[model samples]
Target chain A: MTQPSEKALVPFVSVDNMMRLVHHIGLEEMLKDLADYVEEDFRRWELFDKTPRVASHSDVGVIELMPTSDGEAYGFKYVNGHPKNTAEGLQTVTAFGLLADVYTGYPVLLTEMTILTALRTAATSAMAAKYLAPKGADTMAMIGNGAQSEFQTLAMKAIIGLKTVRLYDKDPAATAKCAENLKNSGLTVVSCASPQEAIEGAHILTTCTADKQYATILSDNMVGSGVHINAIGGDCPGKTELAKGILERSDVFVEFPPQTRIEGEIQQMPEDFAVTELWQVISGIKQGRTDARQTTLFDSVGFAIEDFSALRYVRDKVAQTPFHEDLDMLADPDDPRDLFGMVQRAKP
Target chain B: MTQPSEKALVPFVSVDNMMRLVHHIGLEEMLKDLADYVEEDFRRWELFDKTPRVASHSDVGVIELMPTSDGEAYGFKYVNGHPKNTAEGLQTVTAFGLLADVYTGYPVLLTEMTILTALRTAATSAMAAKYLAPKGADTMAMIGNGAQSEFQTLAMKAIIGLKTVRLYDKDPAATAKCAENLKNSGLTVVSCASPQEAIEGAHILTTCTADKQYATILSDNMVGSGVHINAIGGDCPGKTELAKGILERSDVFVEFPPQTRIEGEIQQMPEDFAVTELWQVISGIKQGRTDARQTTLFDSVGFAIEDFSALRYVRDKVAQTPFHEDLDMLADPDDPRDLFGMVQRAKP
Candidate 1:
């Protein structure tokens, strides 16, 4: 049997390899680097191809393909959201992503994106907070401490010099788990009994509860002036995290208006309700936070460009370290047109 | 490091394993089986989620994601087409696909689809020929002999009892390579110098050329009445094989009209051009080949449902054989919300 050529093999970072890569890079440093990458992509966001994710919805959950390209490299992530999966001891969201060369359409990297998504989502939130949050913000109130809480808190610490995180979840066990996970992460972690206590003395507020319906994790009264709300959880048509009154008061900013209009907190607003594009703020085309007294909100329903940036970052990092294994995934016959001959020759 | 659980493992059929599976089943039998699967999906096409493939087109090539689902299982293929890749010793097209359980939103199978694509394409052509070709068709003229020629020839032999295949290509070396590959496939293979010579006494005509732009492989004068034309290569915008005159005379059948209108041979015709859905014909909702003197054309640009059916078929076949490996692709933490804890514990 002939060996597959170099072109036939795609570098794959398994879940175990991803964990090792994070450890090797140090989690805080990785978060910082991911934030840098996300910010860089945002600065040049006009070059990317953006679309609302293609989703196949069922009664139980939804599966989606999020694809984006930067003219040179194309990337996509296949992710599934089944909130009920947690009860069965499975990850509620599982993902894998690919990066391909736009010139050749050949995949250069394939990686487990469940961990990567968590990392990228946090990085995106932190990057947005850097542009939208009050200057020198050092504390965050993390409501809905599920799979994303620890990462979100750590990303804030990494990017914004946040020194404190007050965590709260409807389930006490979830809050306890999050607090336990962040105990050694150099942050002052506080477990709060309720959402009101979580926001006490915090400059940034993050809401990321995983529910598939219209549930308000943060009501208008729960919010105050001058705080940046990093909303991450309400990412489907009927799912939202903030009350309509809160959105009406805050200076809302979004990743892509078309997508955020369908899946973000702004879905509660009228069709013509105003919002700023984060890319415009990052590029200085528009303002982020107008004044110290006005509230700013980063309504982040994760977008494909963020995934594209994450995949590109991983591809670069994997090439620098021996953390990826080559998977024989493509059939490269000696003659490109003799695919049948190659199969025939492989017969035993 | 802890071992990933069964839920984290997705069954992966690598290129080598896929080759072994094909040889284990015998190529002709596999083609016949694939045709059966394609036919079955066509019979119930209304149940599928059909959309034209989502493509990111660059100056050099195009990368696309083709996704479809029944109510139970979901499948999608990541494929790229770069015409200049063959000059760089790369396959012009390479693909990989995944099948997930819609109920759980978990991936069940991941397989390399380049080889499977060739087989499925041939099977689809043969299946269409079975319904649209003249009765007792035993001879086929395969134009533009390339990677797909041998498979197309053998599939016809297996499904429609084709006894002979006359092959021609603009490049004689491609024709020679195709003829050499099909020598022992129990079909009388003839090498012709031109398209007119290839179709001299054939009842079925297949045109599958791989140029990225429109080029007439079969002109109008070369086509005869009462013949079934299986046009496979004109699958992208601006890339077509059959002349406009041939299409005007033939009773055109398409896999999906919306897709065919943009990417198939019918792109030359008007928007409201009369065509029959192949699925309708297969399901007996519409007629195929109403008379012996009528010219029949199957403008097959390929569809997501065909790939979905192919993935499902491979998943079932690999389940009964040992020709597959388990890939630990998903991060299955002990507690779904404790993903951060899982990563922290993996530290050395």
Candidate 2:
């Protein structure tokens, strides 16, 4: 029998190419679909090998590598968080990731993760909100409006029918930009002077600030009885958003306990702090938003599995479109031992 | 900041492009230069934040992510080890890696590691041989010639003056092919049968087998005094080369102990096994090859820092070359926060 034809190569989505994928798919469809992938991956959380990311701390920022494997597939992302970056006209965090076949170790996809991370973070927030927020909740109060502001706004609109958004930032220009972008998106946008005004009568509170120290954005006195706090900023050992009083009094939820205890809002709490993993809630192993008046909080430190899901989703979507490019990811030698021969053959 | 100019985009070295780089650099000089980088990094080992790689294990093989950072630069490699892949016409191990600016988390270089790894590993072995082997070493006994054979041969020639090489493989055809390729390299090559025949009087003994088990390629009795044994196989948990008596009788050196303890030939030893780190020797903190009468072993398990050096070298070399491609690896928005707006503009 003749040898089988060579398999089609894997597609790659670079940073520019991924933005085009987002433009082609439309942000709303991408976020709504990404949330589904996140939810589904969370439901099968037991199938994955999970670990807190490996981080290298510097005087200015912390660079980290997050990796995970689902037996047959493997993925990892390289990311950095430097709040001082924006002053230099750079992103606070820029990232990229790779997807590989576990059995052969060939990288099938490599894509820019700056935009993708923002998209996945928002999708993950909306995903947790779907389970922890009161059904039919349509208004969100987003504090710390910066690069991540629009993503949260779009995800809320796409996944939960969010119709009104109240925005707040220490910088007024950020809030103005957020409000301006929300125009004609079928959402009523309001700019708030302070965190107190942003939270007034809103169904969800999303905090995506870029501070590395413990500075409470929300106090016990400001939280409503039934509001869901989507805490995304307090994600390092000493960084936090909610005061200890708020966390001690609310129904707390987190992504991974081992990591959340050290990086999420619970990082401010005692090591024995009580919390539930989002997967537990998704699996129905535990209850979420038990009563209409009970408060809920999702401490998002950004897990590896979320990136895994997002990479796979974008990897699939971009392949079907012409937006993706091909990356040189592995070396295929006729005789594996002849690595030198491969170079020799290229000689002029 | 007139749109940050598309010309500023970071370029990527895909598998196809990386192969071109190796071919352009030529095998001998590439290995020689890679060894220089590895040697340089090892000299400044204290500057880097290092950790043992994080791995996910499966029945077939294991996949690992190795990450390291030197405050300003960050790097990681994705690699796998599967001894049975040759039956399927695949390399027993395949890999790829990236190097990024730690300050911005922007990946500046995305490269193929399958060929690069072979280059680095051989350079590393040749590096250790430089320090631990007898100063006048010119003949090397190579056993289990497979995917990594050519790399080992060339690296030894480039770094350690390996003018005579005795080759042995389970498949005689593999040994024959290795000799054919090195016909014009100004080296004397020999094809031998059995580990005993290959090791007769060579000054260096290199076992680069791909079997992922504990089978001994060379027994302690076969090792001559003053010969440096470069153990290239047995990188993961259940694999090794020299028998227990061999390590027990020799001064075993390693790349990183915590990692080598789990993946190197020394894994068969006790947790308290005393092995000098190669960096110490490179840094002049520890003695290497104290006497020709002593049997020495270099336990080689690849490290992430070496990849960092290789990546930096390739990136610098590519920047000087005329044959390079742009990959658009960054997402620098006119306003960084307007990543969402980029999607809107990408539309016709």
Give per-residue CA lDDT, model 2, range A1-348, as digits (tens). Answer: 111113214466766677667778888999999999999899999999896788887777788889898888899888877777778877777777888878776667878788899899999999999889987788899998877888899899999889889999998988888787778688999999999999987999999887778989998889978889999999888999888888988899999999999899998888998998899999999998888898899999899999999998987787778877665456666766766666566565
lDDT for B218 (candidate 1) = 87
Q: Candidate 1, residues A182-259: lDDT per residue as tens digits? A: 998889999999999999989999999988899988988988899999999988889998999999999999999999
TM-score of chain B of 1: 0.99
TM-score of chain B of each: 0.99, 0.95
Runs of candidate 1 exceeding 4 Å displacement:
none
DockQ of each: 0.85, 0.52
Clash count of each predicted structure: 0, 4
- Candidate 1, B138-226: lDDT as tens digits: 98999988899998999999998999999999999999999899888888999999889999999999999998888998889988898
Predicted complex 1: DockQ:
0.85
Question: For model 2 chain B, where is the 10-residue window of minimal lDDT?
Answer: B1-10
